[model samples]
Target: MTYTQTTPDHDAGTPGDVGDVVRLLEPDGSRLADAELDPWIADLSPHELRALHRDMVLTRRLDAEGVALQRQGQLALWAPCRGQEAVQIGTAHALAPGDFVFPSYREHGVLLARGARPEGFMLAWRGEEHSGYDHTTINAAPPQIIIGAQTLHATGWAMGAQRDGSDDVAVAYFGDGATSQGDVNEAMVFASTFRAPVVFVCSNNQWAISEPVTVQTKYPLAGRAPGFGIPSLRIDGNDVLACVAAMRWALDRARRGDGPAFLEAVTYRMGPHTTSDDPTRYRTDDEVERWARRDPIARFEAYLCAEGVLDDSALAEVAAAADALAAEVRAACIGATTRAPETVFDHVYAESHAPLAQQRAEYVEYLAGFAAEEAR
Candidate 1:
């Protein structure tokens, strides 16, 4: 799909399969005195602005809590989505229900907005299976932990949508780190050649583990997909309005039979790579603090408060709701259904391999043998 960004100064995209402009609405909340922001705010209804702020705040808290859960040994590892909430949630909320999403590991915010229960994710961190949810229930794909691998699945799904004559689009959410992966590049080629109705969204958080984005690409990440014959845009990812507008533009065009779009949401990753990586060993506290000042939740909240819709009561309600959500998720995580002892061997092939089944049967007999010995 050909996409142009919507800015306060510029109109969206022109019709007839043309590129759109990338927008930066309300640059720094109160910091930047851009007169253009007022009209943008007026265009966005109060409810939409509040929803954007609330979802970002709740998701950030979820990320922090997930980190604590890992440290407490409830999880093997946790990926923090701290500074990228605005980009994820905004683009997610802008999507229509018919649209499908293929999310990378850190897209907790996107999953939450899509009504994915956090309990589904716990099984993966607790040494169990890694598929977050059944894809048939929601328009979301399973969580792909293998970095940019989701791009391949996304491109394939988009091709299927085209063959099935469905106008619904597909979105693949990845990070700057994944852009270096061969799977991501291969996906661009697949989608471009097929003219699939897909949106490749790169949440370029400016860090890939310890390596800076500079090491990943000297050129802008958005420029990568265009070479594959796909149209693309780079937006200020921290700005919710900009991100949502970009998604809307892309999805609308895709639904109208335009090809795929590649979106680079320029944001920052403010936390460690995972619970295992101690960012303090390489990144500075000053760097984290600097991004903290530009926190997506904080900035969005300031805008909401300025608009006067985010009252003290609304703030308290959101906190209480978010805490309740965390409590529910924790309770569910603690008591997820136990896996069958031999489930690992059940789906290993088209039909169960006889040798594997024999081994599982032997293991069961051995357990029974121990039980009989204890009885004696």
Candidate 2:
């Protein structure tokens, strides 16, 4: 992953690169180094690079800061997407205004890039009962914590979009482990048979709770997509340029009425799967250090420096800006508004099922009884 190392020569397939995992940027920080993707970079301007930097930096800061809040008990739980910012943000950027995105809980970067209010995510983790803002406002569905359920939801959304006379697309993000789930397979079948306008983005970050990605799929995850009749692609998930381009292509295909596509982003989960899990038992520090060498931030910064799009002073300023953002999130977390004590009863049911109603009443009465004792 060192900058001096020559770009890895991949033939679009490696130990399991089933979907033609294209590489536009080198793990060591070279861009357009993938001759196949050179045109995309040549077309990108310096300002675009700056915007990319901002998105990636802010996302990473939020992820790290959110994890800290979890450790401090400000949040009940947080799934850190610490090292996967480039793929998340890049893909989000590729989405159009009418597109819908269904995300797994770890996609904070995608939501942020799609203009999701930070409060929506924060309040959820703070133990709030609902999304702070309506998801449709950002062309996104509410975050789903269940492993692979969002795939079906996304497919259904795409079907609706198709019936409504619009060509807008839907992108569903899931992990390597999700590919094996029946819901995900059924989603693929639905999308393929109906030619739904959807893109299934699988971020194969090499771990499912504690299982390696290899265990999820015998072949490269991307290859599984084509088997379902969806043209699939695999790309260096850490390479910002490649991720953006891959997503762009997928979106274009969907909008053009070409049907759904699947993308397997080959990256790594650099931190614990969640605040509760420990990676040390399953992975070695040396392995982590090796991946760190291919840090997306470091890789892009080096590319920017090489391309004269950013200098040390500029990077220092960005880092400083990121630090301030982190501080702000930390401060905001300390004062995160609590859910109203009565909220637990408010949305328990639509028409009010008798069983649930009884339970809610009992719980409220119990709380009231405790309060009366305190008053006495």
Estimate, for each residue in 1-376, the C-alpha lDDT of model 1 and write its tens digit: 2333222112332211113324454434653333432233346678787787778878877787788878877878888988999899989988878889999889889988888777766666665664656666678987788989999998899899999999888999998889899999999888888888989999888788888887776656666666787777677677777677778767876777778888888777888888888888877888777667767777777767786979999999889878987886677667667686666565456687778889889888877897899999
Q: Once model 1 is optimally superposed onto the true structure by TM-score, how far is the C-alpha of residue 26 displaced, in angstroms?
A: 4.3
Please give, for residues 283-361, the per-residue lDDT of candidate 2 as tens digits.
8999788778878878887888888999878888888988987876776667676765767766555677888778877
- Candidate 2 stretches with Cα past 4 Å from truth are 1-20, 33-42, 345-360, 369-376
Q: What is the lDDT of every predicted structure here?
A: 0.76, 0.81
Q: Which candidate is the best by lDDT?
A: 2
Error of 2 at 162 (Å): 1.0
lDDT accuracy of residue 276 in candidate 1: 84
Per-model TM values vs. the true structure? 0.85, 0.89
TM-score of model 1 vs. true structure: 0.85
